[model samples]
Target: MSSTAHEAPPWLRPRAAYVHIPFCAHKCGYCDFASLAGADHLADRYLDALERETAAKLGEPHEVDTIFIGGGTPTRLEAPALERLARMVAHWLPLAEGGEWTVEANPGTLDAAKADVLAAAGVNRVSLGAQSFQPRLLAALERNHAPEEVGRAVAIVRDRFPRWSLDLIFGVPGSNIDDWKADLDATLALDPSHLSCYGLVYEKGTALWKQLQRGEVEPVVEDVEREMYELVMDRLEQAGLHLYEISNYARPGHESRHNLVYWANDAYWGLGLGAAEYVEGTRTVNTRDMQAYLKRIEAGESATGPNERLGPEERARETAMLMLRRTILGIDRADFRLRTGYDLDTLLGPVIVRFVGEGLLEDDGRRVRLTHEGRFLADRVLCEVV
Candidate 1:
């Protein structure tokens, strides 16, 4: 694709990379990501194939500004395997100076030895999956780790990684406002550099969804869920953490840069099982099936499955959906045009006008952003605009 005159500093290279590790001790009932449980027996084989795939797909060292290794739980691997995985990534995806390297960890899987390996391999950030501090909530979420393990994991991360993030989930089947507030307060006590609070979504095919279907469980009422979200916003802001994106709060200069790459619709490299990559106007996803991915790599065949070349107009609409997630900054009119070659108003003028009149968005003649009321209805607004 040719760059438009408005595309200042056009993307010529990818600065971010994502590597997926699918092995986990247990798969949570709500997870739909590409992750395998009781797959430890295949760990060595998986790593071997991962190494070959990395070398084949990204020949030579590619310098990246950020590399995020997400799970089934990257820390699920034993010490030796964990070290090898870390080193393989470092060799193929070398980090630029002051680059951010993050690894996702489960509280039950992370230990002192694995933490040491990550720190030694230059990992600077750890995202701990601490769903909730309440035992009842934890059981409801089907998370394996005890609430106390979360504090232990945080201690390990704090002693090694310079920056760390904590994750919390709300609106579980039986949770109430008091339970939600306690979770928030416990999270605040940890004093993390970053925090992500998400309302639970029941995806089809998951155990949780099945439970809901069988009448074994009922989701939190919509009214209570809305209240939980409002509480998170107020509490995090009061803690001096600014809302950089919906569901994400960070201290100044601590925003997730890799995620920002996605929100800005910039190019990035993705590797491993079910990973998706977008570069040079094309999007491709690796095979989601573990055995199939391994077979393709061993046979020296392309592991990529579904792929698409996004057209200019389609890319522009998608960009609007993503950039709107940054509630504070929203969409800058000039920058949107520079990045997508489509004037914000010319492309979606009528839709924006409707939303602004509805008090779901703020159009200040310079930028288009979500209103406080709109944040609660973000999904509806984004759906209409896109």
Candidate 2:
């Protein structure tokens, strides 16, 4: 899609790109991302640095097939700054016709002005981080948004964007089955086109992890969490949202294209602090240090923090891990061989046969997917094979 003669060959062009917005009103207990609260004063400088980073990509206008602007609360940017950021990105990373352009927003942060700016700038989708509709659970998760704010954000989004998603967290400490079902009830009331329900995870170094260490909270039983997940699948399907991936459900044709890029093991560009990019068979992660990222941009140096190029054997294993996450459409054997250059039978056939016999994996000669029993034990099964 490049217009210049010096551009990389078509094969090297990225089909997807991601932009990071790293400011928030306050940090959530479970967040470990490069976000700074009480740093609204740095917004102007951060935007300037982000533009510089985008410019360094220097190329004739080219179209990316998908663009996802994620955050530390992308909606935290003021209306004008948000508008400018949207325009700057559109100018530098033009979208292909029908490309999926999405921005992630927190419940209370999104306003009508921000929604208008996003819609006018061609952001056709919004993913609202509405952790829970239950006030007690929201507090437990340290999410700073009223339950009412979600419906308000949903109103703003639905009027402008036809495709929007809600993020809900289940398995919060002390939450019972009724509470989990209530969260689902509230979400379905909005009639969202897409939905993601994730179980609470206490990532190391996060406040939640420290709380666990201090015995301030107890972990939910694994059996209960699994039951919550099964409920999510059943209720969402009954509500007409199909389970396309383990954590994601969507109405027809409304699946997240950008996230699908990662699950499909395809290439994408990541711009901004703490972002990651996978392109041309190499994976690169930018520094999570905001100052380091800004300084590299100011000096016109590569902000590419660290990267790895996987060997053929490693790539095959990685592909298996990612593809199995897709509950419905699992690995395509022909595509696997074509993409990884590893024969399915020669490399993983034995494990596939064993799992199939164990009722963990189902292989239909062309595609291999997890059986219902296998989905619950996905992590263990994938580890054994990978």
Candidate 3:
């Protein structure tokens, strides 16, 4: 796409873009994302509204190095709709050469035709939601796919996309250490370039959360969960995947460039229903209601819900907190100073010293990073930083 000649609005142009597709075949019991099952009937209207929303929010066509299409399940869209969405992006946004374009897929939804369409539309990366490989755990999670479907989907994806990522969840109600290892082994057998392993957390309003409260399901023991975490790190590292973030591991050069924009606190434009954007120094979120989003777009009104402008010190604190989530940690002192216009030590000296003393942080000669223990309690550490 041709770049727009006009200067980008301070809150519009971003280095990365995240587009949310809020439809799924069925919502998992634990999911809280703004998504619904059987919403494909509104797919056409959603696409139209999405384009309008994009036009309103992204006033100038800037070259973006990373584009991440995530959501309930982007692959749930019909092939033609998927192609249309991809083309809409290419037509409206300038993409850098060899840019990272990724789409999130569910094993139950992806097929050969869909994979081909995505590849043809310049989608070079696929992140499959293969939460667990065990049939029992799959049932527990209410995932639609059979255990074998993950392998088949991976094979199809790897045949089409150069880079593929698999998302796995550990710490299920009945998940034992052996089962976790088996899941990891099954995933690695497919030879994916990236893996995102996450510990299960029960949100307050989810069905799983209710079940947890009612004693219908048991949470994994804290020490056992910690052991599972270590297992992932050890096994994935042996498989040659480096731990990039607390929950992400990647082979060299296969890291998710789009998500790094978030972890680095860099500017990004998020479009579509329930999407959030951080551009320049302001953050905005679109309405979660599909009807409201469409109505606003049809009326030629901004679909944004609320906007917040971040001041200099606030931005610096956010940057530090976000960067700390990465294994590489915050950049060297000079880079941090340049980005925030303040000395890193001056702003966070006491917190850093305290965490370092507690063995939760490490200050290498060039950069600071979270220790393994620190990653497990990342929320606490990040709260202290921000």
Tens digits of lDDT, candidate 2, 330-360: 9988977877778877988888899999999
Q: Which regions of candidate 1 fall more than 4 Å away from where they truly are?
A: 1-12
For residue 89, model 2's alpha carbon misses the true position, in angstroms, by 1.0
Question: Lowest summed-lDDT stretch of 10 residues in model 2?
Answer: 3-12
For model 3, residues 1-386, the per-residue Cα lDDT tens digits are 46634355322357689999999999797898988798899999999998988877766566788899999799999999999999988766767888999999999999999999989989999999999999999988878899899989988997899999999999999899999999999989888889999999898898889999899999999999999999999999999999999999999988899988888777898899889999778899998888898899899998888899988998888888888888965556776777788789889999999999999999986798899888888889999998
Ranking of candidates on lDDT, top first:
1, 3, 2
Per-model C-alpha lDDT, please?
Answer: 0.90, 0.87, 0.88
Clashing pairs for model 1 are: none
Tell me how far the alpha carbon of residue 169 in candidate 3 is from the true structure, in angstroms, after superposition: 0.4
lDDT for model 3: 0.88
Where's the lowest-lDDT run of ten residues in candidate 3?
A: 4-13
TM-score on alpha carbons, each prediction: 0.96, 0.96, 0.96
| Tens-digit per-residue lDDT, 177-247, candidate 1 | 99999999899999987998899999999999999999999899999999999999999999999888888
Model 3 alpha-carbon miss at residue 303, Å: 1.8
